[model samples]
Target: MMLKAMTVAGFSLFALVATISLDASAQQDDNLIPNDLAIEAYQGGWRSGGSDPTKECLAHFNSKYPTKRIQIISTSEESRKDWKGHVEYKYQCTAAIKLK
Candidate 1:
């Protein structure tokens, strides 16, 4: 009886570990975003155009991360006139997303 009980306890422990590992892996997969979309957004932000970065970023993200729908929550642009050389454009954006 003691031997049978030990075997059952061992099996239960193994099952518990397997379940926890699978859950962690699934959570990691859910957090992953398309690399191309993130890269494009970073690059577009550095470009010199006065164009809306949020639009460009979202467009790139949608095109590359076609599996998700992104909703823009807010957008803002700030410009500073410096006597130095060229006008500086700072763009900021916030968004929410639904993943499939």
Candidate 2:
């Protein structure tokens, strides 16, 4: 009986540790971007154009949320057209900001 109780206690401790670790990871992810609207600047063409969506996204967010630490990843711009001569320029970027 004592051995069984010890085993149960050990399992409970392990479960508690796992739960805490998962919760921490969830909280970290939540801090990534607070508002979805702020990410709109880098949507659609912005992303396809090879422009780093992070920069445009960060800029948009910074305009409204100056307090947030916004960081943009590498950005690039490219043009691609079909054989029909339909030309379109696009911008893409990725952004990360910390929430207060």
> Best by lDDT, which number?
1
State the lDDT of candidate 2 residue by residue for 2-40, as single tens digits. Answer: 222224645742222222236777787776546532333
Instruction: For residues 62-86, write the lDDT of model 1, one tens digit per residue.
Output: 7866887776666676676568766
Considering summed lDDT, which 10 consecutive residues are worst modelled in model 2? 12-21
Each candidate's number of clashing pairs is 0, 16
Pairs with steric clashes in candidate 1: none
Runs with alpha carbons beyond 4 Å of true place in candidate 1: 1-47
All candidates: CA RMSD (Å): 11.7, 9.9
- Angstrom error of the Cα, residue 100, model 1: value is 1.9
